[model samples]
Target: MISIRKILCPVDLSKGSLLALKFANAISGRYRASLAIIHIMENPHLDIPGGETGAFSFGELVNLYKEERQEEIIDVLKQKGTHAVDYEIIFKEGVPYKEITDTARNIKADMIIMSSSTSEKSEKVAGATTERTVRFAPCPVLSIKTDHDQEKREKIEKIGDLMDMSPNVKRTILLPTDFSEHSELASNYAIAFAKEYKADLIVLHVIETIAEVSFMSSVDLPGYGTTSIYYDGLLKDAQARVKNICDKAIEQGIKAREYIIYGNPRREIIDIADKESVDLIIMGTHGRKGFSRFISGSVTEAIVRNAQCSVLSVKHPEHNFV
Candidate 1:
């Protein structure tokens, strides 16, 4: 069994963070784990001419600000009706990602929970803090998208907040792939996860109709000219690739299935996840090497922000998740 003792959640008090807090609180409650809520107290920006020379810099004011944040978190917990779970809110002054990683390592945390917040410093997809921490953090990170609107949250929340629907339940995991290095890496993790939980694995490959110009170049077809003929070939190719992946999982003693669909990657993925009621979605933040890590418009990023299940987004440069 995977042992989760302590969970560390980093928040910036945004709506995104509030939604993430709901998931963290639910998971902590289900596992009976200790939850530590930490907020990085960034030094306030002073636009004055002698701001740097002042003795009363924002660093000196962190402790006082920390107290205020603590009270704010308590009020949030109350407002959100999350009083059942025991949590301690702490604050630190430093780089957001660095502080979050250090706090997780220092406390020997089993996992880090955070939101994909939009910041001016980082691209809007995975949030700057979340992207950096996922690559370097000592533990696995659970990043929820702020794009989940109220209706979807209510629907999934009623399902017991993603993976914690029931203890040791036979889970269904969705792994969407574009056959990139990181996507392959994510598949390995998904297969292992299925084996660990005796869960069923769903291997999906989306033949994007809209993102076709870029994607179709890579996929080898019969070189057909007509649109229908071209798509038929692409669909056939995707089906084969997806089935082979499912076979790999089945060989590893896991129940597995394959689904190939042609549509918008993000939309199809979410639709299937909701249809199958999958407990988890394992995918990569960056799939193709040609794709920029900072590309906020990637399909994985879209799914991250909209999946009806918990998302485990893997970056290429990452530590092993035990």
Candidate 2:
């Protein structure tokens, strides 16, 4: 089984950060994994007589801050820590995204436990951090948002149980692809996951929005034979994409099924998930910039918001694609 070992929680020292810390503590307790509490200070500078110094120059100052914060974090851990789990605290200075990501990678953390804040102010901060982590982090990230009210905390706990990843429940993985290299990498991960779980693999592709219907027009029906041929070729191309994905899956020794659907990609993907009764959906998000970020690659965001099942979105590293 895939085990979660070290969980990295990036803190901004906000109340929401503490909530995320609590959630991480719970998981670490359950699984007995090491928890790393990381707080990053962004470009902190102090103006001097001559000029401003780089944030990196304040190493001693940052260390002092971390030491103070670390003590407080340890106190929380002591109150909530279980007898079985072990954890440590870390404080670093750098850009929030870069430091957290680097630390996770350097330590080979199995998962990252962070929070998604809901307050208007917190949401703005979280949205950017979440986007960066989701786009670039090597491991899967779990984001939580904290409300300080006791009643709200209970509500959040209930929601967490419903969504809190349980033990070895992963059985089937749905991989929606556009047949790009990024999709292929995601497929590789899905296959690895399926093999680990002895699970079934579902490969899906949608021919929507971009799908064109072509036929010979009566105005030049006979002359447009080539156009008719091209339309047939398009369908063939779509089928080829599905076939290629299936071939890769089979090569990986995974039991594979492929689906090709027409209509809106988002709607079609969700419909397929419901119809197939899948437990999880693993798909590649193109991470197209500008409006696409808000729309989440047009179809991907739609499926995530609408689907009843769990979704894992994998994006190509900019160095690889962009």
Candidate 3:
């Protein structure tokens, strides 16, 4: 079982971030976890009090901003009726991603729930922040895309308006794996969430047949006969592995199903999530960086940016809280 004792939610007081707070509030209430709301001021400039012209010292500015941010958070929580939640407000300066991740590590946060920018243009820039945080975060990062689906956002808003604290609305969760150790780490989270919400689990293994064939053709392979034969063998192995994962979920009293698709992993995963109407997608991130990541973009990041539902990006952590 996974236990979340502390949840860190980083917000910028944007519409999307505040919407994310609703999710944070719901999950914190469900897990009975202490919520820490951290806001990072990238470049803060506060006017002197009483319309004074002199510049305030950095320490003085930080203190002033801290009090202001605290009041804003408190007012937002009070208006949302989430003031009763066990929570604290944290204010920091400097880089947003660095501060957020550092705070999570400092507080030993079990999870980081935040929102991603929804606009196509802004998403590219702001998505980098989310992607970086996911790469360095000590625990799983659950990123909520506020503008992905209108109906879903409306539903979440209604829940907040009604002060409904029941957060386990996830009925179907999609878990895509490539049979790596990172995927195995993500599988643990998928199973735990399935068991927690009593939701059906769909285990997906996507075979990049085109890429495989291209790589095989480029190299001098020995035993491999034709692409068809190689693909069939790979498909059989993937099916078996997926079945094993589903079996484990079933053993834990979860309704589990397995799926094997042959196509672009990113496209297939997104299509399946939309087709299945999945509520959440939990996938593993290899934390790839620099040249390799540039050559082959991350499928997990693509899903996080484009998926119609919420995405939880899991990286193997030094400390196993889940």
Candidate 2 lowest-lDDT run of ten: 42-51
* 182-259 per-residue lDDT for model 2 (tens digits): 677677667766765566898887765333443443222344346555445556787888788778778878788888
Which residue pairs come into collision in candidate 3? Answer: none
Q: Could you give candidate 1's per-residue lDDT for residues 46-151 as a string of tens digits?
A: 4233445765566555545666667767775665433325788877778888899888888887778888755433335337667667656776677765545578
lDDT scores of the candidates, listed in order:
0.71, 0.65, 0.81
**TM-score for each prediction?**
0.63, 0.57, 0.87
Candidate 2: lDDT over CA atoms? 0.65
Better of 2 and 3 by lDDT: 3
Clashing pairs in 1: none
- Name the candidate, 1 or 2, with the larger TM-score value: 1
1 against 3, candidate with superior TM-score: 3
The true-versus-predicted C-alpha distance at residue 177 of model 3, in Å, is 0.8
Tell me, by lDDT, which candidate is best. Answer: 3
TM-score of 1: 0.63
